[model samples]
Target: MPASRNKKNLQVQRSDHTTIWYTVSGPAEGPTLVLIHGWACNRGDFDAVTDHLPANYRVLAIDLAEHGESRSTRDVWTMEEFARDVAAVLEAESVDTAVVAGHSLGGAVAVEVGRLLPDNVSHVVALDSLTYLSLFPAQSQEQTAAMVHMFREDFAAGVRGLVEGGSPAGFDSALKNSYFEKMVAVRQPAGLRSIEGLVHWDMDAALRETKQPITVFAVRAFATQEAIDRYGDRFDIVLVDLGSHHFPVEAPEGTAKLLASVTTE
Candidate 1:
């Protein structure tokens, strides 16, 4: 009829200074699945997996502040800020008792959302994420300044370098291009550098709280058996060996099957 009203037709709103863009799919009367994308990525990351879910399950993916079709502000973007935006979207949608699915940076936000809405969030799924990232800081003040300067001048290049190189075991060429394109589209020059301002937060205790049932589908490179055992108390951690960090892009069937088990079972 009207192009079937794809996500392109969805609306967006500003909540407490952050802009959240979201789209809904599947049966209206079903448990909601709220998705959050990693840094520099958008809701479209979940396009493949959502379709494999049972028809009765509804899917929702949101753009974190400063990423995708959202707002970029002067303030730093903390995990807490990301969580607050998701909580606001939940309120706006009148959604209650949803399963949260997140990737990379989005995984951290999902943890915060679980903490924020303990009663309403039933479960969480973190894919190819970390409690601490693989990136490092410069050893000297001068180096730090250069890092910030480079980011300010060409934010896209800075992000590209991180994604296309030095990323131990996350993605290959095609998947890397897909992820990079999203980052280039969503990230702003000055604000992209704000990552330096965002403190390195440790969520071990927060994750261990295990407010509700949780699961993790991590990349083999980062999600070592040791790490899994350590975090297993909070989540039924599982690792996939086939794909790099961008497992969803290359191994959609496998990823979808894992999520479907938790969602349907």
Candidate 2:
């Protein structure tokens, strides 16, 4: 089949005012893939990557509550609650089986989804996520407090720190600035609360519970040996030089190829 060309903007109501905005493309009966974006990012980040995916695959890229077009008034921002957002979409679509892929924070959510719907999710894919030794693993009480304090006290600085962390040496200043701007402008409360939720999450417990195969596509330059050494047995970490942490947007075709290789397997 030719590459998927038709895209539909859709949403599923989670509550009276809460709804998840998403896009659906490709065949309904095709192998399913659910794409979730990172913190402060919307489903739009995967627009190009979705365009590059094989036509035979069904793609659903979602905006988590309060991110992108999704709206909500609920205060909870835990990873498990975010997983429920993805689950609602899957249930709405009547998806029987799927390979769930997420970028950054979404990768954490993907792991939760695997645990949440073990019977439905066949595999879990993390894009430039789970490699950060400081962020992916569960943190000590003091560590979590320190991280959350940074964001609460100076949110922009915290967001800038994230942008800087993802960028490699000699990366374009303009591009880095663009990412920083977009991410720092994320909706308030949820932005800070989500970071708190992420820092407090127990990834070790989630990984232990999720029984599906897991793969991580990490930036070669930024990926650390320690992370690989630590998670080597748990995840199939493949490194690539695909421009910064936001490779899905920076190198859509390459990202698509990487995802295709995994989904096909």
Candidate 3:
């Protein structure tokens, strides 16, 4: 059981013409765990979590289409599309039952997957994510539409604002600037459309229907109070004390511990 970082496996091509790149590691007889990264993040985002996992458990991490090495899709990407892409990844790997772990946008997709693939999915974990997109309050159609337009076209600027100047978390200024650069560099029309699609997706039906055991971790000092408060008893909440919005990068070990705890039950 040595650290296995460079063991990438395959590219999963889904029905919508979106090719998802993924990696599988761990043991042959171990439990299967699927890790899904947030918007604009690739599978390598989970390197820390995967490294922390037991050598006896199988883990799969995939780059959502339009992010990382995966190709963009023809369809307007919604959370459902993202969830389906994940389900396809698990099935392709011959994983009959698994613990699904997601972060940020992937957390939302994990909810959809728990609802859609209940039988095969054993449990779910959402780290540093909100249960619903409505956590960010809005005033009118004008504001929502404006936000959507920004996310659809000028998303790099939007993400830049999240990390630039004022919003810098407890993290180092240099690290914050570096992440902002990477997130902004991944922008595209398809990525923008996907962000807008996620913004508009109604999660009421899925959240209410989700009965799986869920774990939600938040960096409140990074994410606002509104984001953490939304989980409540609806999910098993674990708040990490760091202020980095980019928890996967700034605190991968702590993130992995919380994720592994969700499977302990």
Candidate 4:
């Protein structure tokens, strides 16, 4: 186990009628590293990663609205709104410049963060994210409906499919069950609606608007060749032999090293 570090829980009120919760660690004056958890995940996902990060790097792990400790009454669940949740935390922390790193859906939020605060966010990092061709690119109406229908009809099954899809062959069934249970129990309405929002997000437009050096640490087993070929010129996709889509939790030391590599560069 990694040594424990002191963390401060904080909240920021957003203009969009949401209160965002986040955790701050490391030195106060160190270079900022904003950590955004993926859909259905909370800031605790990065606790081990933070422990492995350099002592001089300031870390902010955020729980987006309606996830974890964060609460919101807003109805809009767009990727841009998720980015605003992050922006609220950055504003509260007074982060002048930082490398914004996110996992899964949070990866899209990181890109929007770069777009929202072009001057403050210097680099964007994605952990096993932004590789799904169906989700990232604009999907046809029928395609979007079909994807959303799965979650609407059987939420638990939809969550299970996500875990199974991300896991490699011979992966532990126990871990898969654990992931499925946790994700299936996500705060309702928001959990289902967020998936809808992700399906409709236009990654091509977001990429065009957000101009930042992006480094995607994609899992070798989950990432598709088509996704790599399409976004190859746009992003620095580094194929990692990590555990799975949730590799950040499974391999915190390796994840920290990947995030640190970009921060130091």
Kindly list the per-residue Cα lDDT of model 1 for residues 101-120, writing each as its tens digit: 88877777788789888998
Q: Local error of candidate 3 at 199, Å?
A: 1.1
User: 233 in model 4: Cα distance from truth in Å?
Assistant: 0.2
Ranked by TM-score, the better of candidates 2 and 3 is: 2
lDDT: the better of candidates 1 and 2: 2
Maximum-lDDT candidate: 2
Residues 175-236 of candidate 2: C-alpha lDDT, one tens digit per residue: 99999999998998899999999999999999999999999999999789999999999999
Range of the 10 consecutive residues with the lowest summed lDDT in candidate 3: 131-140
Clashes of each: 1, 0, 0, 0
Name model 2 segments beyond 4 Å from true: 1-4
Tens digit of per-residue lDDT, candidate 3, span 1-265: 3375546669877775788788888875688888998777678788777887777778888888788888864666878788888888887888888889887778878888898898888888876676334422222577668878666566778877656532443547788777777777774766676667666666656777887887777665554555546547577766676446567766777776676777666
TM-scores, each model vs. reference: 0.79, 0.98, 0.88, 0.98
Q: Residue by residue across 25-120, what tens digits does model 4's lDDT show?
A: 988799999999988888888999999999889999999989999999899999999999898889888899999999999999999999999999
Model 2 TM-score? 0.98
Q: What's model 1's overall lDDT?
A: 0.67
